[model samples]
Target chain A: MRYIATILLFALKYIALKLAFVPLAVILWLCWITAANYRKLSLAKSDVELDKIDQMLAGIKDKLPMDAKIGFRTNIDPGRRGVLYFKSTLILAPRILENNDRDTILLIEDPHLQPVLDKNYECLERGGNQELNYCLMRRRN
Target chain B: MLFFAMLACVLVLFAGTSLSLTKTCGLSGPLRFPVAFALVLVILSYGYYLGLLFQIQIGILLLSLGLPPILYLAFEKYKSRQLNLSFPKKIGSKNLAVLLAILVLTIRFNKYVYRWGDWDAWAIWNLHAKFLFYPEHWRNIFTASLAETHPDYPLMLPSLIALFWRGLGFVTPLVPVAIAHLVLLAIPVTVYLALKRAMHSFAALLSLLIFCVDTTFIHIGGSQYADTLVAFFVLMTFVLYQETKVSSNRRLVFVLGIVAGSTSWIKNEGMLFFLVFSFSFLCFHFKKPAVIFRYILGALIPFIIVIHFKLKLAPANDLIHGGREKDLLSLISDPNRYWLIIKHFTMTGITDYWIMLLLVMIVLINKMPVIRTLPFMAISLVLVGYILVYLTTPHDLDWHLGASVDRLFHHIYPAAVYLFLLKFSENREIRLWS
Candidate 1:
């Protein structure tokens, strides 16, 4: 009777030890699934906006001159332009992007800002949401 | 034609002149490939510094650097020395399939999610590389206009990226993107290789799976920050140190030095790592002054480049410049500051390294020893250094913690996992060097 009790206790301990890893494995699986999904889901909203900006910048890559120091100006919230600035800098390389919009030969600014460009200086802006949103622009001067 | 040339140049850069030396130093098997790739990044950055000094053209500079390696591959030596180094067969087909699947999915998801990579990827690291691509305007990278992007940071990661861009004669976003993906892949694979080499197959796979599944690891590594590079060097340096400890060859300590010194060349936090690593290594082998001298001798090249960059080219770091405004004593004295760091670290630990931590506990219960591994001391010291930085930082504690704490953990995680598995190894009397 004593021997049987000892064997039973040992088996129970061994089984419980193995059982502990079962929850951990499950937890890890769930964590991976949730974290991956959560990040993907959370990013789902901004991904579209980023893709639109990417498309806008990429479309104008050839139009920008090499070695030109360009500036990006957008009426799209003072807060949001940081992303636009970074993206524009990357998409258009060797063409420097100064944070300032003044005193640059080329600028990639909002299409709605024609009044600002027209009233402020001698410059041209063309292109948009499709062809000429003017995410790409070069002034030949 | 230049693209093919660039590919050949890259092959030479990673697997070039030092193959015979590395193999002799006991870095055999597939492990040597990733390790060699990392060492190449360090050497490439240092070589770039020399090229810039000499006003060498990028194309000419790369071609000349490739000469030795190209010769090495062409000559009888490389073929004669080539041992069979196929990927680990012990991983088995099914495990290999899972591993490949995980790598592919993580990379694809990262691409879908972080197309341009996380913020610092473009704004800083790749931005620095772009400047280097325009060799004439590369000095403009250090101008005061780009102060916020940390021009003071070391050039290892950026220099590696620029080598490809400069080779191709154009900077594409794909260059940084591709390099980042490779580094991200290398981290888990390094963990797997290290453990598998130790004959702990189960622990090895577990580490790989956890790393692959952990979105934090993927998100940050794929983000193209210098932290990913720093993480790799941190693990690499520890591995080199362990190899130096176990091997009969005293010369391996020199390679360990180069690897440790390369840490500082990766990022500013890496400087802190170099200091801690040196201090920890010194504590372990205090009696062996010859080994220490050999280590510092090996460290000379990368360390000199780092010093020259800091003094000549790079601007003052913002943290040091900003700290003058803050009341440092009060921040240090405050209990809440301590609490904030603890809280953030704990949360990250629970989420990130808890599995490794659990296995560490199991090992402790089963066959506990009083002596901690050298990594234990090094990791603790580095963590303490990070917390100290947090206390003194001029930025809002909450904001700074939110932005940086996860990455700080990520940098330490691979090394920690490696250490945990080393501790968990079946060999009870593992002589981990001091």
Candidate 2:
């Protein structure tokens, strides 16, 4: 009877430990999921910025076609280190509308040209549906 | 430095010739002949540097330490040839290529990562090296200096580092750190090859991959901790045991005895592995009661010598004693703490991978028939033994085990990885590229 009772107690302890594993697994899964989502969101924001640059180039008619997709040469945020999104669309013949800016326009996309854009380029706008969207403009010293 | 390099080159050339000679005699594969040769060369080079710093005669020591194995291999070859027994070089070149790639990757990453971890590496391992490099401060080592906090730790790794410092005349401690990193990389490769010979290639490759990326293993490897070196010797001993068991080669067993002794010399926890291995081997191999007693005595001889040197010549400066009466009393008073220690063993950063593999192995065990019953049983015993160690210990469960989960796990990692891989490979063969 004593041996049986001892065995039963041991079994109960084993079960309790095994039960704790569920919560442990759940917590780990939640952390991994959140990290994955954050990475995806950051990457998507970069892609949107490249799209805006393309739109600005399209709005300004240089010899470059308005439909050209511009890849991001460099990503710069002037005021903050947080994630930012930008979009650009080509307006007809000679105008490029940067989602972040309307007045300061830039040249159309050229395969051979490497354009130097300041972090505070006045024509870059944030166009994503998120609440964090904002436009880039040169800050006066 | 130039002299050391030149000596290393000479050792490598000589070891290479020796390996080729063994290959010609049919001891190992034609493809593995070069790989084995190169590894021996590297080990000799490193060992020579260590031998020089410790004021040991390098040539005589190398010949004494390395020659027995070479001679044994040659004898095996001769015996096999005389008996007309066909020796197959089952190992292939593709596996060697993968190993080389992994080694190169480890080297590149070791160069890039400048940061070391806390606890054993920074506090004990690196600190010891610092003292050894600047020997004028040897007295400071025993003093209550901030650097001598964990003086209870063994000196094998720091001694190696000191040798590198003395031989190369380099001021930066990163030289030894890099060497330790290389050993860490080489260990998994060596263990994998050893496993490949005993089991299947796929099993070996998968085990190696798991070891390399396993968060705990990677963390230890990146730091200056002696755990990786300890695991390396443990695995080497296991491999030697398995090889000798299969071949009935007494000489291999003797070499294994030395390796096991070296494992104990690496750290205090290493003695546990040495004890476990000695007990298991004796029970498994010896049929007669008298022979078993003799076998136990033979194994204990090297262990005794190592312990004597550790206690008499280089006693730990810290307060902890190896065999204190108080330790025994404390253990007898509280047993529940032991079980709590066992519980912590289940917790790990990469628990998900471990769980998935465990589940897969369970399924495989049910499905596979040709998978020998012995390997499964052996692995299960090892896992159970690991858990039981925590439960049976007399130390404060939370304070002792909880504080050093990584170190505790690392000490037994070789056995754990081996057992895990054996179970993982039950139903399927390893597919390297896939």
Candidate 3:
């Protein structure tokens, strides 16, 4: 009877480990796939709209004062506008922009925003292609 | 030099809080690092909150950090007493192997952090760090208009990051990245120490392996999500609460209260965890009013900061939003919501290594003995808290559960392991892994 009980216990352990490994294998696979994709997405900044803002900032950074308060105009959806601010902060050199800071460089992505920005700030310079595009403007002196 | 200065300030405060308690209570040597690190984190969180409130200068920070050790040393001098600061007795070869395994696991976890941190790291925590680093505009992060950042979330993670930046006198992505990775590395070490005390070497090592292998845990820890930090404190509170039951030391009990209470300052769920911890402790030790009171009193230290932040600085929490009654009623009435939550909860929990955890427990069950009361009660209460949060959530049940139920499970995973190992360690039938 003791031998039989040991056999049953061994069986139970085998089954439980077998079941557990199924999910464990799945989790490990899912982790690899998701991690790879996530890395790609994080590094794919050049393909994203944020990269254009970075380029625009790069081209116009030398022209702006070190402490210049910059403005941003973008076509990014309302949900994603924070990303615009975050990525732009990294590329804008010593100058920084908070939301709606008065008398600042307005970096524009959408052409529709260009006229809106043009009305508010003096258009400083416009360059870049549709794929990687931007314009820099400053509030009227 | 400035960076080291800020770090030293944190260490001094940690030593004052933890070394005092550890000395008073005779806590074990293995516990010293986890307790010290957790307390230092609490101090850093407190320092940041105070700095924001006072707009404190560099001199004030230096003074706050320096004064504690000076005062502590003087108090010890007056008493002519020395702390028991020796290391634990030498571990066997197997134990050393486990330590080496955990070190390798942490190194891999750091690489994972390098690859993909949570979306929130870039979008929220680091962004807030930017605001805090720019001392003049730090206040702007709390603006009502910037609703997407969830500014109402407690500032401990961001504030700590910003503190590092303040020392460097500039903000860099590296600041948050490094802080997140430090917290990540601390998690496994925290687990290993807690487990070594509570379980046999093999059981403890096996449990640590479970934690290390769980992709969600490794991912979130690396991602700089506040979840793992919350898990660390929750696990520590559980382990320490178990310690208090055995030793009944007032200072350790008081320190436990502070650690548990500080969880509220980490995340909104931390407040719920703090409540669960307190209620569980009170119920478990109904006759021991003195112990309960000491714990509650210590907790009030961090709880005060949490209340002040919520009431004064933070915007209203997004979870408690407009049309509350209707949302609550709809959530309560829907059977589908219950099914949906259960589905996601199981799927995520299983995928997160619940299956492995259970299988290991079952295999070791014959070798295990009866459980302790406090750890079991604590685990049950925390699990119950997770379900309660999911059931009454004001957000859409699917979206809420999908995004966070797994993380919530992950939060309790360490505590669950500690509880499981505590029970397994008591078995007379099993002495060691061999």
Each model's fnat?
A: 0.17, 0.00, 0.03
Residue B375 displacement in candidate 1 (angstroms) = 0.8
On residues B1-434, what C-alpha lDDT tens digit does candidate 2 reach at each position? 44365345445444444454344423353323323433343344345434533656534644554565555545656866642222232223445544443544464444333332334554466555555544333323433223224545556666566545555664344554565556666666765766666666776776666665565566666666777777676666655555555654344454456566566666766766666666666656667565345444545645665565556445453334445555655554565655565466656424523633564455555654523543334344545665555544545557656666666556556655665565456546433332
Per-candidate DockQ values are 0.10, 0.01, 0.05
Candidate number with greatest TM-score: 1
Q: Write the per-residue lDDT of candidate 1 for residues B350-389, one digit (tens) a residue.
A: 8866765665566566655524667878888998999999
What's the lDDT of the predicted structure labeled candidate 1?
0.71
TM-score of each: 0.79, 0.55, 0.78
Q: Which candidate order results from sorting by TM-score in descending order?
A: 1, 3, 2
Best by DockQ: 1
After superposing candidate 2 on the true structure, give the runs of residues whose Cα lies further than 4 Å from its correct spot: A1-141, B1-10, B13-27, B30-93, B96-112, B115-117, B133-148, B288-305, B316-336, B349-399, B419-434
The interface root-mean-square deviations, each candidate in sequence, come to 8.8, 25.5, 10.6
RMSD of each: 11.6, 22.9, 11.9
Clashes of each: 6, 11, 0
lDDT of model 2, residue B404: 62
